[model samples]
Target: MGGRVSEPTTKASQFVVAILAKSGNIVTLYQLDVNNAFLYGDLHEEVNMTLPEGYFTENDKQTEGNMFISLFVYVDDIVITGNDIDEIKRVKTFLNSKFLIKYPGVLKYFLGVEVLRNDENICISQRKYCLELLNDYSMLGSKPANTPIDLGLCVVCSPSEKDNLLSNITKYQKLFGRLIYLTLTRPDISFVVQILSQHMHAPLQSHLNLSFRTLRYLKGSHGKGVRMVKGNELSLKAYCDADLGKCKLNTRSVTGYLVYFCNSLVSWKSKKQATISSSSAEAEYRAMGLTACEIIWIINLLRDLNINVKLHVELMCDNSSAIQIAAYFS
Candidate 1:
């Protein structure tokens, strides 16, 4: 059963913010929890299994019926969102008749992210999660840093630098994992996290030091997060830039991009390019290609949600040569 289960695309915080910004004061959002959601999913393949010790069925077997409602499920946690109040209520009624469920009024918290809303704007933050992470690392009282990573500092792993490696690899892995999750709401640290994650296999002490520095930066800006305000415009805008051959160890360019829907950031990424490029223009062009794909994806998603985006999507780049190359190639 475990191997057969398929996960659904859970709603991202950025998407939620975008939806809120578009909804303005006309739409009402609601949350629903379907108990034992996995049990509700109909299985296509057949396999015999013994019933639980205390359970019984007509023939010691059970099967689920087809799902009818427009629902999004992430494991057991489900979020039911739409503008039609009557339709949303009808779906809840249907689910209640079939399965045990709970309707938590209005969404304030989902997953680990916190949501705060007013009449005109929605603010998303992970302050509670960030603080807990800091305390777990014994950095609650540590001095705050102005920046997450030092721009001039470059980290590289060397076998000869034995004293520069951490004794416990597990601790380094754990910290790295948490920091990756933190990037969800903290775009400021996305680039640094991308750099530090490369050396996860054999992290050096310098990596550990830089990780702590990121923690100190989080301590200073723990309350900072993304805010989406109501707007009349429905437009897509993207900005992409690349640091040519930024990785000293692998000579790979670092690509970074940020995408916004009506001035609200909804998607972003910071990653290393797969293949090495000889020129800065080539790296920038590759970065633009990646950003273009993301733009098209977002456009398709918006179309699915019935959001009419009539304006042509705009792409911004700093390099004129890259822009000219993209223009010529297209």
Candidate 2:
């Protein structure tokens, strides 16, 4: 028996970024927990399933005048926030009448992300999550490293290195999965995690060791996280960079970009280019294009939240030739 279910939900990164962008304002954030969340979704297709002995026991957006409200849903967990307090309460009342829900007073924690706010700025971290992960892997006692990965360390396993393949792939997969989620708050390890993920299909012992190194780095920098300061201008600035032929296995360039709303970092990525570029200029141009797309998306998101980008979106790249090409096109 098999089935597929899909729901519209806000991405973790998108939700975090949106909240950060509006931090220090008169906004209110709250969490709603739905009981038996999975049992409530409408199934589009029919499928077979083995029912448990007590299977029958399971159970499960709007805006106000001049008010902006955002509802983020991950399955049954709902985070409601807006500038209008009355509207938020009305939403909760309406939702509670439809299904069973527990209203958590504030969003202190959700999906492993811990939210902390001060008078000046809002900080998000996964310190508890990191500690739990380290303890689970028995790496809590490991000496902390200064960096997530060794500089100039290329994780390339050749045919002659077949013997170096990890014997148990499940352990590596689980650890890697956790690392992937950790990136929601730990952008510092993003590049290394992106590199490690490429080898999940066939991880080598060396890759496992490198994963350990990431854990050790996490040990040292667990307190580090994204900080969103209040009163920053709602302007977009981006920086895009590329390392030509950085992927040792495929010879593809790596593209990295960081997008900020004023002083707060909202979006960033470290990824390998789809195809090989003949020149560093070409690689850098590709990165610029990707960054532009992200900027456009962020602008639209802000527009939906009733925030306008009045100033020009600044996209910075170090490549002179690539900058000239972009300017000429404009």
Candidate 3:
């Protein structure tokens, strides 16, 4: 799916260069995205097909398997990620050999989010994406809202009034999906995405309204992205958060964990726990245990990087009792 187009590199690509320049790292950069990634494959089972652009038919002698896999394309944009500069360059070279390579160096932008590489870190955000979303939804002319959610504005709706609520849900659901993908590079939005996701199944008007609030928040913090800078050598650290009794429906707490490698963020999670905890300590401990599990996996990943973490993968939590429990339980 690697090929070239008329456009320059992604916005994130530009931001990455700026960030790297700021950090004074001898950073090397390259860029490529999945080539006609959609065109490359076909639905294995029965499905309706739609005519694609720049359509070309294969020879009569060509078999289905011989047919070129159409890499999916969104107006020529594609998704590709890599860590090794040499490897990325290699891929770019190979793609150029096959298709016209539009040389967009380094991934400055992906999925509308801007990226910057600074001081041993990679920062990503979607301030621009947010603006576009607002404009696309016609919120550009509408007044900006102050909060991501209005706690006093309840979202509960009755079944008979489902139509209005359902409409809002559909709108918000679409946004939530986008935001969820956005979480890949922006952990700051994880909590809100998680909160909004709970209502996806039966989104009411209130739910949709809150979703708009989230969009407003994004508007305010548009172009924000994570900066995975190298930190204090190659060490593994984890931070966890849990909100006990946060959900009114089930009284279930929300738990979150983030994993960093050599001070660069690698993994994160935010979700509701299965069961309710009796106390803050219990809740914190549950979250800590989950965070530890992630740490273990991260440890294995780092091993492949030729990095070894000698001490315990440190887990940080704001709660003292949780810290004590982690000390004894882990």
- The model with the greatest lDDT is 2
Model 2, residue pairs in steric clash: none
Angstrom error at residue 149, model 3: 2.8
Q: Which regions in candidate 3 have their CA more than 4 angstroms from the true location?
A: 1-29, 41-103, 118-122, 150-164, 261-266
Better of 1 and 3 by lDDT: 1
RMSD of each: 8.4, 8.3, 11.2
State each model's CA lDDT, in order: 0.77, 0.82, 0.62
TM-score of 3: 0.68
**Clashing residue pair totals per candidate (backbone < 3 A):** 0, 0, 40
Compared with the true structure, the alpha-carbon lDDT of candidate 3 equals 0.62
Q: What would the per-residue lDDT of candidate 3 be over residues 89-170, giving only the tens digit for each residue? A: 5665777786654656565765576766554466666767677777877776665555666655444544455435574346
Instruction: Write model 2 residue lDDT over 1-330, tens digit each, in one string.
Output: 101112267676567766776675677678889999777778787533322345443341122226656777888888888778998889899998989999877888888888899788888999999999999988888999999988998777553445477778999999999999998888889899999998887888888889999999988888888888876577889999999999988899999999888678888889999999999999999999999988887777676666777579899999999999999998
